[model samples]
Target: MNFLIADSFTSALARLTGQEQKQTKTAAFDLQLNPAQPGLQMHRLTNSRDPNFWSVRVNQDIRIIVHKTEASFMLAYVDHHDKAYSWADRRRIEAHPRTGAIQIVEVHERIEDTGPLFANLTVEPDAAPAQPASPPIFADLSEDALLDIGTPSDWISDILTWSEERYFQMSDRLPAEVAEALLEYAATGRLRSPELVPANPLEHPDTLRRVQTVATEDELRMALDFPWDKWSVFLHPSQREVVDADFSGPARVTGTAGTGKTIVALHRAARAVREDADARVLLTSFSRPLANALRAKLAILLADDPAKLGRVSIASFEDAASELFQLMTGRRPTFAPDDALQAAVERAIADLGYTDLAPRFVMAEWRQIVDAWNLVDLTSYAGVPRIGRRNRLGSKQREALWPVFEAMRAALAARGLVTRAQLFASVEAEFKAREEKPFTHVIVDEAQDLGVAELGMIGALASGPNALFFAGDLGQRIFQLPFSWLALGVDVRGRSSSLRINYRTSRQIREAADQLLPQKVRDVDGVEDDRTGAQSVFEGPPPTIIECADKADETRKVADYLRSAVEAGISPAEIGVFARSNDYLSRSRAAVAAAGLEGRQLTERAEDFGNCVSIGTMHLAKGLEFKAVVVMACDDEALPLQSRVDEATDEDELKEVFETERHLFYVACTRARDRLHISGVQPVSDFVADMALK
Candidate 1:
């Protein structure tokens, strides 16, 4: 008989107490080894809707529910003895007739409460005049069309009676494919036909995600050790194409927040290494902390095979460039401090007799244009398109500025120091001079944050037909300015795709955060990415937004939120608290302290956060998620980052400060999987206000 594990088992297992979970896993492992073991004390369930349902003793009170057939033994659910039996009584495993996918359908006939199921939604009858009732969401769909999306046979009447808002409240009861399909059709006016039935019903696309055939002890062990059912190995149907497709040239996958871009990147890297035994893959991102998280998840994804993990190297873009530079030159690259660079710029301006240029303009021009592009001579500086600069420079000004930049570069070199731009340039040059590439594949996460010099090095590192792939959301482009990837020789024009189904965040949280960005975001290369018609698989309560009178009140409110989240069963380690910057971290820290829970500050190098509520700046919250999140200190000046706006020399620079700042807040807000709380001093940030008004 084939032994299988259902997603429901893992989800139920996660909620058990530690001691109970330990005992349950032991029982499960033994059952997998020998389902007929006499010591398991298996019993046939008398009340179950599915005759195959049976109970295996986990402990005196806890029970492991299993479904047994002549050819298959599947772990189905687990809980206290009575609750476990109750769950089995209300559910039955069967292949969906239309989609040919296996689903555990709820036995609604056994449910006693039909009043809640048919509750009518209402408007405020006391204050406002009576409004016309909106039409039911699925009233127009024929029964055949309803069955085509995998809706259970008995739930057709319940669905057709649901209005738009009412459907959202009860959508989770339907099968995932049904809810997703109906949601997509309602939101975008696009309907997908039912999947074709495969010969092996288990091979159906939906079955592949919901149910798995465990062929070995190791696979079951890994499955049990994973965090939750949501993190199952199966990719969403949309992500499967991007992960498996072969790109003729450089490729990219873009999406909004929580759309599983990083997951696709990791799978693509693993796929490359698996397809070729000699492949050397480097999975990378823009920051150290995010890279560490990726490495940990990659280890779990590839834990079944040590050799596959050995073929992949993980690093941040900075670390990768630095390692290459040191390897080629036999010495570590030394970087000039920002203060020293500023001093050099000051001296250069004085020496070049240019007194009119503002320091902001001079610095931005040198960093974004000269150093970033490796402009070595006056001609290159003269021809560079300063795309984002609002203040255009004349020929005379360009000539005058080039000499100052030259003097500053010479001064930095005299001190045996280099800028990040210089280090990557040297690495790029070394990569070009070599006949053999360092890695066969380069997969970049958070690719939107990559800088010019980093891209230059990456362009050289990933030159093969399938060598380069980028994964990121344009809305999450917080670090880098927009640039032309085609001009840099990494063209994704024909090979780009955007993911629309979000797996990480809740529908409520996603919609709130989406308000902070434009509906359509275009890149400098004229690649337009639409944020429209995005959908989340699950629903959550609307984010809690509040305004406080003072720092003390803000701290109290945030502390209350933390306690409430904990009381609601969200563990401390699964919670995160963030502020705009380190300057405001003390307030969040105090709130965590007041809540009587440990708080670990996330630094650039933080990896193991232990069992503490994570506290950090919003910037460090990238690529990290939690069950609950608290974003505080959103006082007007703290959020748009007053210092940046104050430093902006032109309208363009000022606009950039707001855009990126909003993106930063959006990133922090969407990091919560289920719950989010935003509190600030009186006069909250404009971004917070946008969430409510928009």
Candidate 2:
């Protein structure tokens, strides 16, 4: 008989202690090896609604809930003896009638009525009697419309009169697709149509998501790991469609923070490797840490087949490009630092007699137009379309500016050092000259942060119709100015999808962090993030915004908060302190020190801090998570950093500065899972004021 492990079992298993978990795994392995062994005691649960439900003895107190039939034995749930029996008693394994998908649903009769809507109310004898409560908002929807979406038959009448609170309490009892649709309808007054009926119930896409047939120990281990990462084992119907889709050209998946954009990208990479025998997949992200996380998750997903895992590669975008550059040039490229490049521009301008123009403006032109598009000569630089450059330049201005850019290019050539953009340009040229590209498919996570030249290099590496796929959130873009992807030959205009379910953050944190942005955020390519439709899976305490009289006062308050959190059972490693720039990290460390705890500075390679609190800039905090986060030193001029604002040469550059700063704050605040603390001096940055935290 086949052995299967359900997500419900893992959810229950995660609660057991180390010893208890180990005993439970031993019981599970035995069951998988031989279900009918006489040494194992299995008793049919008389109180369960489903006849197949049985309880297997794990120890004196712990029990495992198993659903057994002639064909298979499925591990459904596990807990202490009483709780395990109660769980099986309330739930039944069955195939949905209309959608024909297998689901473990709660028995309707087992649920208790939520007594009265309001408690402790008194009615006067003289007052008129209250009318019966009105029907639910969806009462007008036809039964056919409701059933089409997979709503259970027995619960339909209750749903017609159920309040929103009652619905939330019983939502897990319904099929996932139906519950998601009903929640959306309650939040926004619009109902969506249901999916078409599938040809087979057991083989339906939605059914395959929750019900997996495990025939070996490897599959059981995969199921056990699902509670911590449900997205990898169980894909939502919407997310599965995106992963399995066959796109004609480059495609993108966009959503707000916590939505499973990264999940889709990782699964897509795996799917390509599994389906195509000759496919070479490259899974990359914006930073080394995130790419490392991706690699770890990939191992869990593909553990059953090590051969397929060998076919996939994981790396940061820059690392991958640098490796490919070395392969082509036979020498490592020494990139010119930002300051050195700017100095080259200054020296070139002073020597070429264009000292009248602001050095800032000349540098901006070089970055946005000259370097970004790989303009090699004055002729190419003269006609390059400055996509987001607000200042208009006529022929006289172009003629005058070309010489400064050309001079800077010449200076870099003389030093034998190349800029990052120039390096990507060289890599792209090499890819075009080769008969075979390094990767057959390139899946990019955090694609929104890629610069123009990087996108061009990616396009050159995998330019087939189904060669490239990108996943990122537009609101989380902390680096690289906004540029048109279409102009660089990677257009995802018609083939983009947005994920709306947030699995990482709490509702309070998500809402408060959203206040820092407008209702809608759109990239230069006209793709918009559907922020309104996004919702968190859980709720937490609203953030506390602390305003102090001075820096010392703020630091003291922050230290007290940290100590209190630790006293309340949060470990030091679970807490993170961040600032707008490295300039304010000293204050962050001081707060940690005052709290009587050491702070570990988070770096690109250092992720685990053991028992020390992590301190870093907002940029470094990207792709990391914590139980709580403290955004320190939001002083009047620190966040927007007076120097950056003072150096803006035009309206476009200044606008980009503010946008990136706001995104930085949002990213830092959302990294928190439960509590978020935003502290600043009395005259705080304007963004803190916008948070309106209570």
Candidate 3:
């Protein structure tokens, strides 16, 4: 017989103590090996609503609930003996009458006793809002229509009596697809078309998210090992379809943060290697920490298949370019350091007798336009878009400025130095000249940050059909300025898509963070990342927004918030403190010290701080999550980092600085999972005011 594990089993496992979890896992593994093992002491629950329910003894107080039948043996739940038995007695698993998808339902007879799945979703008695009777959000739907969406028959009346808030309150009791479907219908007044019932309910796309067959002892062991990381095995149908797709050419998936874009990239890489025995895949990102995080997750995803893992490689975009450059060209590329480049531009201006132009403007133009696009001559320089340069330059003025960039280029070459763009250009040339490429497929996670030359190299490297894939959010584009991907021959026009459901962040947090950007962001290529109509499946408290008199007052408030989080049972390591920049991190460090807790300051690398609360700048908070987050020191000078504003020479440059700064702040605030505390000095930043936290 086949064995399966339900999402309920993982939820129950998370509640047990460390020792209890260990013992329960051991019992679970043994049962998988031999379900009829006499040593497990399995007993059938005679009084269960589903007669197939059984209980296995884990210890004196713990019991494992199992669903047994002629064809399948499934682990359903685990808890203390009494609670485990009661759970089995109150729930039933069956195929939906209309959709034929499997669903685990809370029997209607026990509705009054059912508690909130997430503790934070439950409001205090004094804070509870009055719930007056209101019409149902789905009042127009009939019983058959509701059942077609996979709602259990017994819950129809209760669902019909629910208002929008009431539906959100009781959503956890419904299956994942049904909840998401109803949410969409309520928001946009659109319902998906119904499909005919399937012959085997277990094979339904939605059913796979709740239950899956374990093919072997090893597979079961892997599934139980990372109960919290079920995304590695049980994918949402939307994500599964993307992973298993074979695009005609390059494709891209864009979404807001926490919508599982990274997860899609990781799985797509695994799928590439698994499908083609001779294929090699490169999974890359623009940020080092994000690349490291992807490597770690890819390992957990492909742990059961080492051969497939071996076929895939993970590296940052710049690092991969350096490696490929060295492999083709005889030596490693030496990049022009920032200080040296600044000195070169200053000297170039002095030598050319052009004292009117600011050195900062010269540097920005050279980096973003001239060098980035490899404008070696005056003709190419005159034709470049200069996309964000609001103060347009005339052809006569461009001709006069061409000599300055030319001189800077000569000085860099004299010092045996190459810009990052030059190195990528060399690699792209080598790849384009050869018929064969290093990797058959290239999947980029943070593709929004790729530079012009970097995209060209990736396009050349991924030369085959269905070879290039990208996943990123346009709103999260902080590191790189806007550039047209289509202009570089990496078009995602027809194949582009967006994920609209978030499973990580709470609804309150998602909504608040989204205030930093518009609901829809369009790229230069005319593609849109529309964040409209998306919703989080869970709810959380309004963030604690605090503004104080001075830096000391801000530190004290953040320290007290930290203490409260710890007292409320959040681990110290599960909390994080962020600032606008590293120079301002001392305030966060002082707060952690005042709270009497240790903090691990994050570096560019992915390192474990070992039970210490994380302290870092908002930029370093990317690709990370915490149970609670404290964004401290959001004062006027510290936020827009007055230095960046003072350095801006033109309106376009100033606009870029402000947009990136806000994006960085948004990234930090959404890192929180449950709670958020944003504090600032008395004369606070405007971004804090935009949060409108209650």
Candidate 4:
């Protein structure tokens, strides 16, 4: 049986066993060989009392025993430790009862310290003579073994440890084959790759048998025909491998813009639901628009199996949470009270003598009333009158006014004077009554924009085997608070993966836009496409940076570009004019209209081709795509608002907003499918001026 020790351990063991090593002292103890075997008895020895005596069990039930004496330490024995050696030393037993048995072996001794002992025992010394360090030979091995040294079994064990230690580094270096194999090993502790695992034999017995018959690599390659040219939803080869991993634990994906993250997520959802018709798979997105889009795509993907469709639920985080809250509370939740409630509350506060305070002040005072009474039932204050509007009311005044409002609300509900405010109050009352009951899962999209309170509300919906699948581009936060999904009670880092390929953009378009965008981004894999051809920013024209004297010149340049793009075979329906502010968009729209070009304002939900030309503020254009994008009024002041760089605000938030703008511009450029035209008036935004088209 071979005992494989690492080079260091082997060196340590060698040193400890050496006679010349002063520290190599043997310790005497009862050496019971084969304790479980019949006729075996413990034999004690007292000739030496050295703690350096070493015994290690290795593969195939073999144990190596070592001990030191005055002149030389012994490589005492190598045998199955489970067998009987002899009787006690006091019993006059034969040292070697078996005539042909060899009890001891000798080897050269090394140094005598703890360091050498540890090194000898744990590591194997390099067999090669002193020479310059050579590159590892396994570097060019098959993708399967490129990541780890040793045989397949050792590779598997190495990966498990590697994943635990340098997970991030390993994850970055993970080859496609390794990822595929790891997934298989995770699901079944065997060294089988996912591709080698037979598909459901019951469904494809003949195909499985045929695949099994293919023995050699050449035969296997010849027998199987893989479609490499087909369009796939995976963002990267690693993502594709993970999807095929079939492991039990949650998986994570992370990626830059246009990396097909949504596509991979949708595919994972579909595959999960398909694998088990009874499994309840929930698909969630941060935004309603993305949710709706995924739902539509999934509906088409799973149309063949009606039962499977029912098992998959695609919903926005809020909608899903609201549904769960309703299920637990036995009633729907009212959204936070709108302007009408504020107005009503102000009126009551005014009647109570204080009119200087805003509705926010009245709401704060109302909160105090609820807290004081310990009244979880907010519905009781549905029609309540406020004490004062804005003035500093004493505790006594607040106390006196509480009963009046409570009584008024009770009286109103009894008389059917309940308004939307009353209905919303009832919902709040219901929510408070059953706040403990959580939902099964609450998935969020655009989580980077979610606030802590919003996340808490969503978290409250988790009651059962709950899991959150939040997808967000931190670089695209247009909202106020940057929500951290990790902080929101989710193991984001563990389940996270990335889609880095810009599937939506052509190579040239991606390159050009990347150069123009000021954020650091890694290149994407598999972004090239042959059918639609490469996307060049120059296909239509060089980004027109017109020197506009003022707003009028800006409008003229936009109008002229709009007409020229159309005349140059670019469809008007494909063109979009984006501005940093809404005012600029409106001006551009009027200017285009006066030039006899039909223009429409673009919105998040607006359908494509609704207008001959579209105009929009940058914020409004997020998540929307357009072919030919013209960025107008690219002035320094408007491009990067001072608030964007404010130290008080989160840097990540600013970066996200900045990246989103860049990605949005990239998205806009890619929308053309064949041509991308970008235009800006000078002095162009810093970002536009730095643009380089490939």
Over 387-451, each residue of candidate 3 has an lDDT whose tens digit, in order, gives 87776889998999999999998999999999999888888888988898899999999788898
Ranking by TM-score: 1, 3, 2, 4
Q: Mind sharing the TM-score for model 4? A: 0.47
Please list all clashing residue pairs in model 2, or write none if there are none. Answer: none
lDDT of model 1, residue 509: 94
RMSD of each: 3.2, 4.1, 4.8, 25.0
On the 0 to 100 scale, the lDDT of residue 227 in model 4 is 13
lDDT string for model 2 (1-694, tens) is 7676776788688767768988999998899888888767999999888999999999999999999988668888999988999999888887677777767887776456566954656856857777767556777767776777777777677777777656656776777767777776776767766656677555666666666777778777666655543344557656777999999999999878777788898889889989999999989887897888788788877877889989988988788888888888798888888988889988988898765878888888888888989998767766777766898888788888787777788888888899888988999888877778888999999988998888988888876867999998888887788878878788898999988777678778888998888778777778777788777656677898998898899889999999998987677888999998888899899999999998999887836576799999998888777888999999889887778889888888889888888888898998898889999887899999888744
TM-score of each: 0.94, 0.86, 0.91, 0.47
lDDT-best of 1 and 2: 1
Q: Which ten residues in a row have the lowest lDDT in candidate 2?
A: 225-234
lDDT of 1 by residue, 117-158 (tens): 567856456676768887897788888898888888888878
Off by over 4 Å in 3: 36-41, 110-133, 194-201, 215-217, 228-232
Higher-ranked by TM-score: 3 or 4: 3
Model 4 CA lDDT for position 208: 21
How many backbone overlaps does candidate 3 show?
0
Candidate 1: where are CA atoms >4 Å away?
110-132, 140-144, 228-232, 353-357, 433-435
TM-score between model 2 and native: 0.86
